[model samples]
Target: MIVRPRPNWFRMLLVVRGSVLPAILPQLLITLAFALLVTLLHGRVFVWKVSLTFVPFSLIGLTLAIFLGFRNNTSYARYWEARVLWGEVLNDTRSLARQALTLVDGPAPSRIFVHQLIAFVHALRHQLRGTDPAADLDTWLSDEARQRLQGARYKPSAILLMAGEWLRERRRQGELAAPLVQAMEVHMGHLSDALGGCERIAGTPIPFTYAVIIHRTVYLYCLLLPFGLVDSIGSMTPLIVTFIAYTFFALEALSSEIEEPFGTEPNDLPLDAMCEGIQATLLELLGERDLPAAPKPVNYVLS
Candidate 1:
């Protein structure tokens, strides 16, 4: 995601990296051409005068803008929810690590649990984005655990299961007290909830019907706008139509980009930076000296 400070008004006008304008440029150009043609012909082609008045366009435009606003709101809600889930992941993982380090006596089991927690975070991130987690998992998990996760349908859940079993083993050996075990279990439950929330957001999307209806309405409205304006706006039809079309088309494209926030789009959540932050924090809790440097935004993008 783009994480720069807010730009001044003059700079904002020229900002382009994270905007949806690039994706909708072709549509803008086409709208301009169509509006120009309609203006030149006085909304007449061959023997037909397809000229229209502003009344219908005005009514349709108002309704279409409302629908677009609702759609954008729904998409933004999903984006914000996904971000909140990741934040929960970070908090729960840190809590788990702190509990294990303070309550558990055996350093080996505590270290193992922290490693598995890190693996869980990495696995969840890669799984949501549909990328292979083998490389990251191998760094922390054993050959047996790694091989086991390779065949599991959901690697994050599998890793969490390993963590649970590890805690159970320590409890059986009288290393972990019963009360601490229950406490750690609570944190583990939080981890499971975070995982489930992320899966829900990644798997289910805003309904396709809403997307289709908004898409067709925006295009139809933009295309017919020139016919309505050419008669009254005269030579300025292209300029006027193109400007309005940009607003509608850009909103449509922006909603589509952010609807699936797990993907690697510029507007998507910064999962890489987030995962790195989690890793650094957990390793620091373990008193590791070779901690990784913090992640920084590149060209205003934090991916």
Candidate 2:
């Protein structure tokens, strides 16, 4: 995700680091070339003159813009929901770590529980992004615990189960009160809810047919725009068509990138930084001052 301060308007116009321009550049060039050809040929293919009025283009453009706006809004809603779910995970994990340290009697069990929570955070991040959790798990888990996780299909859920067992053991040893156990369980349940929400968003996407229809319409409209404007706009058809195409193409590209908020794209959520932040903050709660440095955005983008 982009993390830099907003640039001035003049610089904003030329900024490319976080914009969709790079993604849609090829489409823009194709549209420009096609528009120039149409203008030169006077909207003709061989002997057949392709006559089209701006009226149909105008009506279609308005409707298309509305549909695009709706789709983009839907995509942004998904993006925002994913962010909220991650926020819940962060908050719940912090609460769980606090409970483990303050409510539990022994330092050994408390540290183990905190480490398990950190492992769960890292595992959840890897699960969402479809990356291997081995390195992250190794950092937080003992060799035996990591071996146990090797057979578990869902590493995050497995870590959560480990955490629950840890709490149960503490309770059995008379180290934690029944009420405190229940309180920590509530936070654990919230963590489970957050995990489930993230999975749901990652598994289900906007319907394929809806995306296909909008994608086809946007491209068709952009490609055929020159024919409608060439007769009236004369030599300015390419410039005008290119500008219009840029808007549609950029919006479509941006929506696609953010729709899957777990992705590593510049516009997607910064899951890497988020997971690290959760780890550092939790460790800080346990009196550890030698924490990992916070992630910095590379070229104005955090991932």
Model 1 lDDT at residue 165: 97
Candidate 1 residues 17-110, lDDT tens each? Answer: 8898889999999989988888988998788999599899899999999999988988999999998989989999999999899888867779
Q: Per-residue CA lDDT of candidate 2, range 177-277, in tens?
A: 99999999999999999999999999999998999998999999999999999999899999999999999998888888889999999999999999999
Candidate with best lDDT: 2
TM-score of each: 0.97, 0.98
Runs of candidate 2 exceeding 4 Å displacement: none
Q: Could you tell me which 10 consecutive residues in candidate 1 have the lowest summed lDDT?
A: 144-153
For each candidate in the order shown, give its overall lDDT on alpha carbons: 0.91, 0.93
